[model samples]
Target: MPTGTISKRSVDAANPESKDWLLWDDDLPGFGLKVTPAGGKVYVFQYRLARPGQAERTPARRYTIGKHGKLTPDQARKRAKDLAALVAQGIDPRQQEIDAIAAEDEAARVAAEQARLEGELAFENVAATWLDHYENEKGRRPSSVRQAKLVVNNHLKPRLQGKPMPHISRSDLQPVIDAIPAKQRGMRRSVFAYASILFGWAHKRGDIPDNPLASMVKPQAPKARDRVLDDAELVFVWQASAKLTDPFGPFFRLLILTGQRRSEVAAINWAELDRSTATWTIPADRAKNDVAHIVPLSKPVIAELDQLALAEQIKAEEEKPDGKRWPKSGFALTTTGRTPISGITKAKNALDAAISEAREKQPLPAWRIHDLRRTLATGFQRMGVRFEVTEAVLNHVSGAKSGVAGIYQRHDWHDEKRAALESWAAHIEAIVSKKQKDSKVVPIRAAL
Candidate 1:
């Protein structure tokens, strides 16, 4: 190796036939210019890097600056001096360049990861995952799952769908929570509870840093419902119900006669009925309490089931253009008979209209289908039916047989429940017909 001040003229004048020789600068020990056999001249720096915690020197590393013409001798000398200063301070310039390139690549990776997360963990995406878990994984009933999706899609998603997960705050949710009517306390509570659960789920999964609902207070607690239809209202409902068309009309009558949940009554399957024994078995999955309940069908309930069965038979006989005939779904209250009845809103609206027209009175008090269940229970209690027997008739699992007693006591009160339901059904018939004298027993098979 030769040592001298590296200039353009000196580099160009050097032997073209020389086999890749390096000329080091006399002013700067490690700074040099490499001249190849093809006469290409480039400024370069060579230095031996010291091993950590040792006096031993490793092999020298060569770093290219630029071509001879790109940087003059003065500019090359200045750049080389700066690099030499870095070497004196125990820093490897070559390693520093490699680390800088790696830093740029790491920064790009982080930016890309952030962009992906922004799209994937938005409020709508999290809500979709939550809904899948509720219906598919947790095995919730279809009706309940439908309601949950309604709240999320109609209310939650419209407001928060595109918002970033971390950017969501309690303020973002408070207005939505406040918008739900206080009179519908139970629904408000449920909607808020579902929203809180969604945020909590995202937080637990590391999708969001914190739950916005955690800091926000929940909607007001629901008041206990005690509304039961009086005799006048009961008569009004019964008469109006008869004027209703098939399926919806019969469905409402069953709601009153059976004293079961509206969903349970509306979604009843024909296969659940046993005509000879006059009994309808509600499966565990369909029951609100998740317990398989046996409902002893009275003559009225039996007659209603028979009416639905007869209609289905008639519909099945009706021929289509293809001559395939109408299909029969296992559900009792469906229009198409291929799926369960889904026009609850339309049915209720029609019932309300009929009731108002029949009464000609100052706007009837607002009531839901569930009020019929309460009405039946209250009526049974007034008729001197024992509390336990009435509870069993309603298939309620609480009261005397709740908690440890419920766990230990296995008696189902089958006989008592049957007698109570039969008695209640007979009483409802007498009221609907506006007949007096409890002594006169009303057969449940009478026309509605």
Candidate 2:
């Protein structure tokens, strides 16, 4: 090492005498310029650690300041003095650098840990979040939103509940696909689609860096079911419903009698029905089309609703206290009256059992609760109900009323709707009355 005031000219002129060497700055001790064998010059600061009680200087530690040309001699001297000040204060610049690096590493570790915990977001958690967004945040159809929840609860969460987002791979979901029955291919496809959409939502929100199911090929398209119940099945549905208990029985009858969706009929609140006018008004939020719907309550529909209301009133009376009674739930088809009747699968199973028990030789064909809605729509078309009127009764926004026609044709067909439902109800009554008389003479046959 050579000691001197390191100048730009001197530094540029300095040569490595057959090897790399350091030229120390005399003005600022321990600060020097190194001349490499390749003729590159860089500034460096060198110092020894301080001792507590011992007089001897500890081992020296070196710190690189900057390059020669990048930081001029003056700049390097100023930086070197600042570092020398640290040394004089009994601080090790090298230890500070090491501590700074360690601190940075620790911070990075903590960040990584936080990210890891956040990444632990499971399929069930994301499903709930997605439902919240669907119901509360976005203007989505309630039916579709409910379907998403059903898909998550019945299909998704049961399979992929606790698994972390990133750790869930394609293979992780294979069992879910395989477990679905072959007959429910449509449902299997729907579950996959719902999961795919949910995971995609999580990915877009940066909850997960990537969607595991993004590259997954969707399940094969299911065979479309257009099986509508005929006149005989309608009779069987009407008659067999009597065997089912309260709420479920009336619920089934209303599905056929009103020609409305299962959810629509089941979700009817007492307040929604006007006993004077015999009309049920479904709010825009509850309607599948996102529009308010008015359903004319025919004699049969009104009778069932009155019966349910009476039962609720009796229940309220029974649960009454000293000169005070709690009001019953506003729901039309609720066992608890507080919440609408759910666990439809169990209800359907009970209906199936009753149907089987009613007709000994033959049972009703495998049909969904939605099939009753389809049956009503088919029956309406068969009974000479106008297309627009039937569409109004069903609350459907398709066909001639789908596009611009829907915007222009604002006529709610209030009178026509009432007539249509009345006609459908009378038609159903004829079928039921005919079946009652012919029950003993004829044997129950499967739908043709």
Candidate 3:
């Protein structure tokens, strides 16, 4: 052992010997530099715990401050003075270091647990998981899945995002239900239904302690829509749709001509149509009822399709790079060739505006795009078409063709459906062209 001032020159000059040796600082009693036979030099502080006026002393414990190159001689001396102060105050510096490390580890564990709870219990995350289960596990229809997603993204997520699932209550959700327009009662009911389903699923999966929507009063189902566009309103819509932009104009016209659902009409592939047979085949996978349907293309429908095809070809020609040919097949009603037309709500709003402008009178009563199918069914019935044939045209498996009757009745009513659609198209043409005198009654034979 060497007793001297621990200076930078002295620490640098120290060398390892056959055995470890200590060089004690003159000013600090227990602080020193220890050099090992392996040529390792480290700053150290050795201390024994003792209280004032006590005779008993604890065994000596050495604290390694740092290596020689890592900590300068002056830096090691300052740290040793801190340890000496703790010893005079009857505190054990080594135990304090152990407590600090343990506290840091405990703090890290708590923070990680809080983060896990946040990620697992957030409303957005729970809803995403519920939707995946709803679509895949429950095997819901694509349209149903789409409607649920729309309600979540447009109505629910904006209001409840990031909220803890366990903390959500009915009070947090009532305002979301109240925000929808009063006139949109059906939409309000749909929002409530989707939210209920999501929370219910989360509760069942133990992701939530309880369903927040359980006590909330669900909105009553809206009354069935009986809205049918009158002849003048129908003609107004037809003429107005023509004045609007591409795809939408033709898309709306196809809905009227075919009496098909908006989604089915919008997703029409070019390959689904046969020019020679003048028929459009909606495959089972795409049909809402999961039944393959063959719709006869009336002259007007075929003509409208031809115009759409020509417009698409023109667009392709304009957009294609020089010497590159555009692919001829994709969705029939699409802006991008890869996907079907979307934003129908915006397009419908535009159509409503056009219809309002065209009418210039009492604004047409609130009607959904789905009302077009009802109107077509009503038209077929008024024209004396058989009930079964009308159902076949709309591809409905209810009424005449449901249950045991559906299982046994193999007749597709192909001819009757074709005639009914052709007559309806002619009726629409007559209304649009201003050639028909009375819209109330048309010859029954025309439908048969």
Candidate 4:
């Protein structure tokens, strides 16, 4: 061993021999530089655990400070002094370094696990997975899927977008249910149901440790809607619908004339309409009851559809200069011929504004597009149409057709359905024309 104050000059003058040699620092005991025959130079610190008032000496332990070029002699000395202080306090510096490395590794592992949980259990990510399973795996109807997505995006996602699934408690979601307006009781109930289903699914799949809303009381189901538009309101809505642009204008009128669901009517393809048969056939896949429905095209219904077709044709002709040609067949009512008209809510808002403007003194009550179907059903009842005929016309599987009767009575009621719908159309014409009340059923073709 060669002893000296470890300085830059002494370190530079030191040479490697046939064997490894150490130059111990004169200023700091146990701090030295080791030069290997392989031309490697390293700074090292040797220390023994302090045993206060003991006759025996603990075994010496050595700790590698760092490579010489990587750390100057002064920098290595500062670290060696730190180790010496720990050794004087009866701490083994080498064991302390080993323990520190172990703690750092444990901390890194825990952080990585936390990151993985965040990525996998985030509310948005889990909700997306659940929705995909709900729609594709569970085979839910398109309308039901759309409704679920609407509630999640519009109500839930805004509140819990990036939150971890397990960290979410009932407190985080209760406000979401409570925030829905009283007027939208159905929506409130739907939000609660959707949240419960999502959390329940996560818990079942082990994506979440526990369901946050497991103990929360579900919102009460909304009362069945019996809202039927009166004759005056019906007339007001019909007249206001005229103020809207293409697609929506005819879309609203067709919804009223045919008494079909909004989605069913909006998604009507030109192929679904048969002019020769004078019927719009809703395929089983599109129909809510999973049974095909034939809606008789009364003269008024045909008239509205014809006007839509002609308007689409005229617009296509106008677009000919722009290299656009009319599609041979597509959606019956669509702004673009490629797809059915969407943004129905936006269109309805515009229609309501028109209605409000038309009747400035008396505001029409809040009503949904679904209310139109109910209104038409009520109208059929008042027209003396048979219950079975009305059920067939509306394609409802309940009432006269449900259970034993539905199993037994397989009547298509084609002619009776036509007569009922025509009568309903005639009644609508009467209301719109202000010609007569619904008491006398006028022939729709004569009225047209």
Tell me how far the alpha carbon of residue 408 in candidate 2 is from the true structure, in angstroms, after superposition.
Answer: 1.5
**lDDT of each residue in 1-448, candidate 3, tens digit only:** 7889999889888899999999999999899999999999999999999756887888899999999999999999999999999998899999999999999999999898678668877889888888888788543567889989999999999998988887788998999999998778889999989998888887887877787787888787778879999888889889889887888999999999999999899889987888778889998878988889999999999888787776766765765333222233688888887899998999998998998887775568899899999999998888888899989999999998999999999999988888888888888988888887545546545546
Best by lDDT: 3
lDDT of 4 by residue, 274-314 (tens): 87788889988888877889999998888777777667767
Instruction: Give per-model TM-scores.
Output: 0.80, 0.69, 0.68, 0.70
Name the best candidate (by TM-score): 1
Task: Decide which is better by TM-score, 2 or 4.
Answer: 4
260, model 2: CA deviation in Å? 0.7
Q: Residues 117-196, candidate 1, lDDT per residue (tens digit)?
A: 67786778778988898888554677778878988987788888788777788888887777777787877888788888
Model 4: weakest 10-residue lDDT segment is 319-328
lDDT of 3: 0.86
lDDT by residue (tens digit), candidate 2, 183-207: 8888888888878888888889887
Q: After superposition, how far is residue 181 of candidate 4 from its true place, in Å?
A: 3.6
Model 3 shows how many backbone clashes? Answer: 0
Identify the runs in model 3 with alpha carbons over 4 angstroms from their true place.
Answer: 1-113, 131-146, 179-183, 209-216, 315-328, 360-362, 438-448
